[model samples]
Target: MSYEFITLKQEGRVLTISLNRPPTNPLNGVFGQELFKAFSEAEQMEDITVVIITSALEKAFIAGADIKEMAAQDAAEAEQFSKLLQGANNILNRMKKIVIAAINGHALGGGCELALACDYRLMTSGKALIGLPEAGLGIIPGAGGTQRLPRLVGLSKALDILLRGRTMSPQEALAIGLVDKLIEPENFQAEVMQFAQELAAGAGKALGYIKAAVYEGIDFPLEQALAVERKYSAENSKTHDAKEGLTAFVEKRRPEFKNE
Candidate 1:
């Protein structure tokens, strides 16, 4: 399927969704619609085990939300726009497949929120900045940033970033646990694809279960979280891949998981 503001390419079991808006790649209503459409299409594809979200522009992964568009919105329109943003963001967390954010450049405001929604973030080293800067614009992150940021980086640091609307370098983001890995600019895309391909080669159902356990269990109490983990673990163990894995282990061979 084709998208107006995004492009989707699939290679083997991995799908790459690149934001196509030029120069800044600012998020808007159209962007949100197209993103959700791309994700919906991805969800329907049984072969796609991993999804990578990135930008086509070299200077900005996503500069921020489209201010010109927002400036024209009234209360009702703004509320509707927020709903669209939230729906788009929800795909990242609620999808059964893993999503990786390849932060090639600056990701601020809504851009940062988009990255935070992903399961893993691989950012390019150097001048690229990432953070929630909505406070500087007299608003707050309308997506999941306010909730997901603290979950990833802790309350104090999340508050510091949100309140100050601070954008930090890749190194600082890594130190704060915002990004999972940092890659050299020269080899960033190749490394990200390689890492994603490695994940794609694993047991897809098991990976999905792991993601479900972590995401769904996070908000629950300790005992409840363990119960959630146990549920997924038990369910995953019944899959064909799990049986193959055990058989391969006893036979002293690498298991070829079919993602069953």
Candidate 2:
């Protein structure tokens, strides 16, 4: 299906979804819904082993939530707004495939939260800043920002950013674990796709299970976390990829994963 707010392209095992709105890729209700739909489609496609979320423009990954749209909302409308935003975010978070957020530029407010939802984030080295500044506008972050940010960067740092409504530089973000890696702006796309391809070549179901265990299990008690890890790992061991990997190890040869 054609999308108005985003562009979805499939290249081999990787699916690319680019924010098409220029300057500020504002996240509106419709945009969020469409993004969720796009992801839904990508998730069901067996050939799409990895998903790379990016921006079409060089100026910004996403400027922020669409403030104009927010201004037009009442309490009931606000509830609907939050649902749409959360819905898209939930899909991204629970996706089984590797989802990489490629921050080509600044990611502000909801944009920042969106990036936080990804399995991994690769940022472009430059002046790109990331933050949730909703508090500055007299509104708390309606997305998962409050919860995810603190979990990502610690409570103290997350509180400082939210309360101060300040943006963090790419280097600072890297230091706080907000981003996994940085790529020079000149080689950003290539670096991101290379990483995505690397992910695509791995065991798809195993990767998803590992990602789930790390992200979700981290929040549980130590014993509970270990249980979760074991459960997923045991399940992954049943896949054909796991069998091939074991066989290859025994043979002392490299394994070619089918992403099963």
Candidate 3:
């Protein structure tokens, strides 16, 4: 399959999708459209048990949205652009398979929102940074940034970062729970691939359910969250993978997961 602004490469159960417009992979209408199509396909691919969002270039994961494109657009055009981007962002958040952001370098504005949409984020050490600095650009983060960032970090922290419009180092981001893992710059790709493969090797169905439960339950009331967990647990229990997992445990052998 061909993608205009991205590259999709699959190795084993891990599907690596890299932003192709390098140096600074700036998001645009075309990139948003292609991302929606690419990630939607990834969500449906049973063989792709895990997806890693990364950049092909060594510099930055994504600098932010294309300022040139936005500068030329009118209010109506900008709204349409935001809608497309938000739609794709929602698809990423709701994807059943785990999505991990391999933050090789800077992630700002839309870039930060992209990482926030993922199930997990692993940032490269050294100069790499992640933050939503849209306020500096005279705009707010229109792509799930406002909501997700607050939930990931605390309300006060998220507000402070947004208000300051300052970028954060990888270490600072990790401390605030913005990124789950931090790795050396040289080991970034290898470590991300290994992590994704490890996730793929486990019970795939269970992973999906766990992701769903946490994401859905987070927004629900206490009782409602418990019900959501019960519902997902029941759904997961019906899968053949769940049965095989239990049986393999009893037999004291590694269980083969088919992502059923």
Which has the greatest lDDT?
Answer: 1
The estimated TM-scores of all candidates read 0.96, 0.95, 0.97
lDDT of each: 0.90, 0.88, 0.89
Task: State the TM-score for model 3.
Answer: 0.97
Candidate 2 per-residue C-alpha lDDT over 47-99 given as tens digits, one digit per residue, 9 for 90 to 100: 77899999998779987988988999999988888887777887887777889
TM-score, predicted candidate 2 vs. hidden true structure = 0.95
Comparing 1 and 3 by lDDT, which wins?
1
The weakest ten consecutive residues by lDDT in model 1 span 1-10
Task: lDDT for model 2, please.
Answer: 0.88
Per-residue CA lDDT of candidate 3, range 141-241, in tens? 88888888999899999999988887899899989999998899888898999999999988888898899899889888999999999999999999989
Per-residue lDDT value at 41 in model 2 = 86
Model 3 residue runs over 4 Å out of place are: none
Tens-place lDDT per residue, model 1, 1-260, is 77777888999889999997976999888888888888888878888889999999998999898999999999898888888888888888888799999999999888888899999999999998899888888987887788989999999999999899898999999998999999999999999999999999999989999999999998899999999999999999999989998999999999999878
lDDT of 3: 0.89
